[model samples]
Target: MSIFKQIKGFVFDLDGVITDTARLHTKAWHEIADQVGTPWSHELADKLRGIGREESLDIILRAGGKQDAYTDAEKTQLATAKNEHYQRLISTLTPQDILPGIPEFLHDLHEHEYLMSIASASRNAPAVLERLGLTQYFPKIVDPNCLHTGKPNPEIFIKGAAILGLEPRQCIGVEDAAAGVQAIDAAGEISVGIGDKDVLRGATIVFPTTSTLTLANISGRLKEAA
Candidate 1:
């Protein structure tokens, strides 16, 4: 039987999985790094995937060898600056930015009466969803602003499931980052990874992209895993 047969809810990550905001986030981080005279690269930005803003800032500061140079208040200011840049860039987002196949999948899930929630590490998730016309698809969104820790901690996924009124085992967590997969796994939920298998090692199933996912395909994978 399909494992999804028992699943009542889904927790989805926002950035790379539902949209292309990951690039925008990378751009914002790069801008911040440049302003601080830090050496920034795509490789460094990749490490920020699925991490919260402050934590991501910490990683960037450490990578630039300025971790100890900044006080807590200074770090907060840097993080805020990065977010300002990100918000300015994302202000132009529209419904057209929704990833391929995601709208159809969301509609299908809604029609099927499967409860869905967003478990993103981004504090700007609500604004992004609204801009993309996707706010109606998810009733619950775990607030990253309130979180002390981000992905790989399972707190966001756990909070998502709770808001959906379901147990961890009753929901599936979907993500496009390694830290996100680890979070889902740690939360005792099935993980559907939307990225390379090599990077999404802890995922229960891995899909090359969201465009390749379907309810039927997910069911099949669940059954096979079972």
Candidate 2:
């Protein structure tokens, strides 16, 4: 039997999973780093993946040797500035910006009657979903704005399963970040990673990209694992 047969819900991460907006986030963070005279690199952006905006700002601040220099209010202001930059960039987003095979996959899951939710660390998840015309696919959106903690903490995924009226083991969490995979594992759910295998070490299954995944492939793997 397919493991999916035992699954009742599907929880997805935004940014790198459903869309290519991670690039926009990286660009915004880089801009913030430049503005603060902090040394920044793609590696630093990678570290921020699946983290909340404020936590990401804290990471950047620590890297720039300014974590202790800023008060809580100042940190909030910096995070807000970065979010404004991200908002301006994402304002142009549309359905075409969705990652490869995501629309089809979502449609397939929808048709199959799998309950779906978006569990993202991004505070702008709702705006991005609306901009991409993808809000119809998910009935629940667990973003950082509603959660007290971010990915790798499992609160978002746990809330997603709760909203779907399912247990963690009855749901599958799909993600594109290492921290997201960790969160899925920590939540005791099946994890489908959509990025580099090496980085997504804890995922139950790993696909290099969404383009390499399909309903059939997922079902087959679930069957095999079962």
Candidate 3:
């Protein structure tokens, strides 16, 4: 049997895959960088992709040559401040904020009866989805609060698959980041990358953009991979 034929569900990463909250994240991080007197650049923001908040902050601090400046307790406060700001930014979101074609593709998946859940590193997944008016499409989000490790470790994806009552190999994991693709691959799932093939080269399949992520297209690609 084709590995694709065995798929029963989908595990998704939130920030880039579902919407453009990545810009909001960058904005929040920029604020933090200013507060900490760090140099913020496009390159620095790219490094933060697909990682947990604390890890992202560490990279930012390191960029400013302040990696060892703060104690763990202080780092926690910085992360908390960034998250609060990001949450506030997302609070204004409406259904209009959902990325192109995502709403339609989500409906297609729902029509096909595929189980879906989230494996986002963001602790604010529920709030983000609710703001995007996509809360109905995803009910199970791996609690980032409970996970000890982030992406590239497979813990979140593994938890996401289990919540959907499927094995890792029985689900397709979708992401827009290299680390997320690595996590899905590590979890033994078929990985679908939704942007920049070069950046997401670890995926089992790559689509140029989120608009291309439809049921028919995904099914065709899966058949080829199978």
> Whole-model Cα lDDT per candidate?
0.91, 0.88, 0.91
Pick the winner on TM-score between candidates 2 and 3. Answer: 3
Q: Could you estimate the TM-score for every candidate?
A: 0.97, 0.96, 0.97
Candidate 1 differs from the real structure by a C-alpha RMSD in angstroms, to one decimal, of: 1.1
Error of 2 at 110 (Å): 0.7
In candidate 1, what are the lDDT values of residues 56-82, reduced to their tens digit?
888888888888988899888898889
> Deviation in angstroms for 175 in model 1?
0.3
- Give the candidates in order of lDDT, highest first: 3, 1, 2
Better model by lDDT: candidate 2 vs candidate 3 = 3
- State the local distance difference test value for candidate 2: 0.88
Q: List the residue pairs that clash in candidate 2.
A: none
The residue-by-residue lDDT of candidate 2 on 1-226, one tens digit each, is 4567788899999989899899999999999888777798878989999888888988898889988988999878888899899999999999999999989988988998999998988878899999999888886887566787777998999998998899999999999999999899999899999978889978888889899777788777767766
User: What lDDT tens digits, residue by residue, belong to model 3 across residues 68-182?
Assistant: 9999999999999999999899998888888889999999889989999999989899999998889999989999989988889999999999999999999999999898999
Return the clash pairs for model 3, or none: none
Each candidate: RMSD: 1.1, 1.3, 1.1
Q: In model 2, what is the error at residue 12, expressed in angstroms?
A: 0.3
